[model samples]
Target chain A: MTVATSDRAPAPAAPDGASRPTPRAPRRRPRRGTVARYAVLCLMVVLLAGPLLWQLSLSLKGAGDTLYERPPRLIPTDPTLTNFTDVLDRVPVLRYVGNSALVALMAVVGNIVGATLAGYALARLRFRGRGIATGVFVAALLVPIETVIVSQFLVVRSLGLTDTLLGVVLPGAVAALNVLLMRNAFAGLPDELEEAAVIDGANAWQRFLRICVPQVTGVITVVAIFAFVGAWNDFLWPLIVLSSEESYTLTVGLNRLRGTFYDDPRLIAAGTVIALIPIITFFVLLQRFFFRGLESGGIKG
Target chain B: MSSSTDLAVRERAAAPRRPRAAGARATHRWRFVPWLMLLPGLAVVITFIVLPFGNTLRLAFTDATLLRPGRWVGLENFERLLGDDRFLTALLNSSLYVVCVVPFMMLLPLVLATLVSRPGRLMGFFRTSIYMPVVMSSVVVGLIWTSMLDRRGLVNETLATFGAIAEPVPFLTDRWLLLFSAMFVTVWMGLGYYMVIYLAALANIDGTLYDAAAMDGAGVVRTFLSVTMPGVRSTMALIGVLSSVAAFRVFGEVYVLTGGTGGVGGRNLTMTMLIQREGTGLQAQTGYAGAISLVMFVVLGALLVVQLWLQQREGRTR
Candidate 1:
């Protein structure tokens, strides 16, 4: 909320001297609008969070409470964490969590390295075929992932990477959006910063690391978050690639909860809650960087 | 700095030489860098994106199967698609989903942006609440919605208590209602992300315009129509195109909700599911699926181009 105030500096300042007298004359008018705005926002908050809260409440219920419906209760008459325990016992929840974490970490590392290098090359270096390359990358953005699924499956099988964590992580490691984001962030850096380093006898790699990388740290964080979430939440590719239950990611594991539906409603709700945790954590951690990066990038130029 | 001075003196000293040649050499050097930057990403795109696209294009023209190999059938797959009733149903369902959802997705975010633009105390909370679902995995969101919209789920239970219905509605399984339910879930999940994009654009707006409009005695609605809307028109255009593409390409919701059966008389089926079922069904028809995908690609590609074209026009208009 404090962030809103920082943004407000430009708001009042934009009116300046011409409207200075007007504000004094009608200070109450702005307050009225502000109050109305807050009311609308409060409604939106309920709309957004209401369902999620319902899910949380359901997850806390005992199995009997879920099925006993003259009407479904918002708050269970008798609550239990036994459902969470049941889910933990029936499925390899911890292993799936580890697999998701491993895949996300590898993808994030791969994307950051590959995108930063590509971003720097596009942003700094002068070379032949630059325009053509940029054009191709932009055009590639619309290539639907579904169109390539079969071929990608074949490609992975041929490489003998199928069913391995690497198969899922590798294909997603370098994305056009990340490269584009990094390039835009790098472009905003002053030329003098790079030139000054070049005069000091820094090589291309050194200049990128010492001068440009620091400047685009915010974009790097944004790209990493995107890559991590993309890998973490992905299901179709992992489902296609991984054959064994021991190797299944959280999404595959959660999907299996559908198989166990008749077992217990408590377990089902518990599993649903468990599946949402990493996603919620991932977003909360990265949103600070995400918002800051977009502000700095100027809405994709 | 010293080397730059030396280089400047050398360049000045070499002014009599082939200066045009030096400038051209530098330009050529600069050109290679972008290609270098593009190489790894291009390789990924080529392998993961272009090669598959090429294969799908070729496969569309052939009689391919998961087993028994493939032969060049030359438009037979596409010809079959034209007459296929299920394909038409899927097409209609997907089209309706996009049409129904895009307006809500686009408008709600704009409304949200307008509300949050006032520099309120809870604006961050508002932005975060909306965006929470965007960052969540589609699969998890699908699972969550499944629970929330189940017959005995919270939504129906809530409606039942209010006596909105005599009985709990078959929200997911009902033929007439399934697609709407899915669209509602999709919009609920996506609203926050588009809001962030709108907020970003709103942040860039010059605040003086609002005061100017106020001085002219325009109220909130008038100011929003004439000032705020135009100010963020480009972002709105971008979000519109992105959300439409998202709506068209939606698979997770349909897959999870209807389990690729397309629910009640195949009414909830989408093009992506049809493509999946064809490629991977019990009786695998890779060539037919490939053909369907090609049609989808062409339709989407044309729409995307139109979207960009409209965005450019709108941007210029603003």
Candidate 2:
């Protein structure tokens, strides 16, 4: 189907050329426009990525090199890995990364399992209070967590879960948005397939596990990425919850690093780069799924 | 629960394809299955979200603090807000932020989406690069921009080199310019994220409509105004509300940029920061913080209703 569409795309332009007063001149006009468009786009890319790249350059430069050199270069003249080594030496970078990973992984697992179950029930089953359940889920999206953070903290404290990773994971374990996305994904599946499984003596759990869940891998992937990234990038909650430096996630840890190394831009830059690498790698490796998920879930900025 | 199950049983019985004996047994067994599936999720929501929200309301009326037991004092916390200079400043700052930032958040993305909606070899790279900031931790964004906007940072250095100014501008220190600088960062971080949304909306538009408009001798601008704008009207409304709500809830950006001081001279102080201060500062006033949150909730809820109503009216008219 795509091939046929691509084949037909050039035909209209050919006929337009035939009808135009000067085919050669008209062709050049579009080519010029295309060039101009690309030029503008390239400029935008630099503008958008420039600061990060500049940080990256600063992160690589040796301590002796002047960071504020005139006609600032994005590529360090004398690059070294000492900044990275210094960051790792000064801070418990590995421990912080591990904490981030553990928290993110727990959130991912909880979101996938919990949201999938609820989403399946909402989409495919005749549930008691289904309307109310869905309404609560939708309303949860509108209640910004920050607004209720004070009480949420008190609750966590009451539960004896504060200063723990579990406390960090539990509140955001199953986002309403992820549940809704999973519901939509489940609803998009063909009912006939599920009905056939039902008629073949499959139980509800069997049907869900074998048929429905497999079909919504795309949504699952999307949910997993969102949950992981959210848990990882989160700063305010972890900052509020975790008191000891040993329990800090990468973001909170980086914030501490900033406070301590206020005068040392190179160390801070290195810490920033270290914090960014995992997520950037995740994005680059799963670029396709990331875009698909963002498109499907309509990610909030 | 029993009544609901009875309704479900009746709903199943009314269907034509079911074999009587097997269907009856199945219905009996599965009556509670959906609820079982929903149990874990509902438990979390009730415990974490619903209860805390209720507690926030309850705490707003009392003089609750970390140590002291609370006693009910109706409207006292809220009445104090009427005269609190810091709360008023935070409210005004948030209002100015939403007003100044939401339009650019909605429109800039539209412009970027239009530019890249056309197919090109580098379109994917451009989209990803622009979106890179959105995926990064806000901590990194705050840190990078804080350094860049410093008096001796790259921004001032570049301007100085270009002879645009004689001295460095204190982007973060100055009172008025601080909010605008924060808004600039907000717009930058959001541009690609919203652009992706607009692109998704644009892709759903039928290509034949543009062809039809062109056939009617409509120019590019005319086609865009008549076809493209209306096509993504719903998305525009969605982004408008989402961005505004997000702006109203702006905390992390301000918190990180100001080193948790809410910006120099409290210029960048937002409502969330104010709430954090009152709730968890050295002299914590939990009740006042709850009142602030409830007020924010009411304000945001009203804004949402108005926007959604406007969108619905627009939809019906179209």
Candidate 3:
């Protein structure tokens, strides 16, 4: 695939001897353009991240502090974690975090295992109805979850999984996007790798497990993060299925906080921050893999 | 060089391999492996997606409720939908939202992607920062923007400070403003997500194309139109369809922003919101909700078909 070549090829080619000597000066006016580009980028960042930063500032403010002060403060003058403490005191913050963690963990495991297996089969193996299976998945990608939510809820209820973390986790367990992404990743691998294994008397499963799956670690990581973040951030489905407080994920829990702490914007902000931290942390830590995976999975697929 | 060498090795290996008998035997034996691998996933999809989807179609004809089994009354629910004022408002609102959001979601991201497509030290940070909102939950985004759009919120405060308005605008309370505000937030949240996709598409365009364009004395707009635009056209079309579908099905953001009441006079009520209200609200019109979902499905299905046709045409021409 072009993605495989573009992702890997450009980095090493940049330092060619012919192009290295005059890097600072080509036909372009480099200094002015660079400054303008940086200026535009900085403005874009501020505009994009400003509200989130404001949310952070709000979370840090004292409860009595008005958010609508004449000139809004980007920084809290009297910074405190009282809102955080208040949110914890008012609600089962730890319990909600635990529930979110469990759901996201289950979703991550389920997506990685399910998507990998199915994707590997779709991409590499010849089987009955392979074309139909691929077609079903591609079609499923277009079916918005919201459109099917009511019947999905009924189906979950029929299965007796309502108000449970499993109810929240089950429907999202095998995202079609992840399956397709994994399939693309597998398809991009050099056929030689698998053929080499096959010629050595490796079974189909053995070749897939040892040789194929290992090569797509990048895509796997991407799928895991997407699944994790998706589960963590999901609101509507979890809201519909999980009715009780104990079973509520962080998103649901935070929504409840909005009702309970409606008068206290600071506490709500604190709850928002709590809900945001984990996925943001995941994104920050795996930022490289996340972007690379998105590039390959998104464009090629 | 290594790929050629590997091809040679593969050819040599295949040439020395056993004849058709063993190959046929192996193929027969391995035929079930793919099915085995696919079973669990297919089971999930069938149970959660396929079954529910079929059931939704079934439920739409009946008067289903949470507490009661449906009694099929064919076309009644759809007929009711035709006269349901809330359903009509929702349809109009949803269409308006799609019209407002889809173009911005498409064009803004393309512009941003082009601007930041070049690699540099800080480009990574810029890309990530812009993308940060996309990674956050819709609930959190809703919360953040809800507060920001408050009468005493930062948005109005900034505007007032600049003397742009005489009074605080009712962003969340006023119907048109609320829709616009929601659209703005949706675009903001989506900018980086779509930009990343565009950037990836941009990476595939050979840099030498730009060099060639420059050699022909094409200015910025000319080069972009001739080279960059054509290069990302398929991706743009894909994003257009995806974003429109998303717009048509918008719920969480509006739900959170309006605190789940569909805002004043149901002015900003989207079709998904109507479905949620019907299925789960006090009246519990589950069958009606199903009918609405079917309508949405039809709309989305039509879009998908158009997109596929466009893609096919693009392929054939190429």
DockQ of structure 3: 0.37
State the lDDT of candidate 3 residue by residue for B1-318, as single tens digits. 122222333444687564322212323444567788888788888788887888888889999898787799999998998898888999998898889999988888887887777554345667888888878888889998888888878889989888898889999999888888888888888898899899998988877787787677775567778899999998899889878888888888888888877887786899988877777633676787899999988987898787888789889987
The 10-residue segment with the lowest total lDDT in model 1 chain B = B1-10
Worst 10 residues of 3 chain B by lDDT: B1-10
- Candidate 2 segments whose C-alpha is farther than 4 A from its true place: A1-29, A297-301, B1-30, B212-223, B281-283, B310-318
Candidates' RMSD to native: 4.9, 5.0, 6.1
Model 1 lDDT per residue over B1-318, tens place = 223222332344445353322223442334344455567777887777777788888888888876645999998887898899889988888788778888887788888877765443355667888777876666667767777777777777778877898876887888768788788879988887777778778878887887788778777678889988888877777777778777887777777777446786777778887776677633667788888888888878877797779877976876
Model 2 C-alpha lDDT per residue in residues B253-300, reported as the tens digit of each score: 777778878776676789988887788633668888999999998988
| Winner by TM-score | 2
Count backbone overlaps in model 3. 0
Against the true two-chain complex, what DockQ does each candidate achieve?
Answer: 0.40, 0.39, 0.37
**Any residue pairs clashing in model 3, and if so which?**
none
Q: Write the per-residue lDDT of candidate 3 for residues A71-125, one digit (tens) a residue.
A: 7878888899988988888899789889989999999999999999999989876
**Which runs of model 3 end up more than 4 angstroms from their true locations?**
A1-35, A63-66, A299-301, B1-32, B212-226, B281-283
Which candidate order results from sorting by DockQ in descending order? 1, 2, 3
Positional deviation of B272 in candidate 1, in angstroms? 1.4
CA lDDT, every model vs. true structure: 0.73, 0.79, 0.79
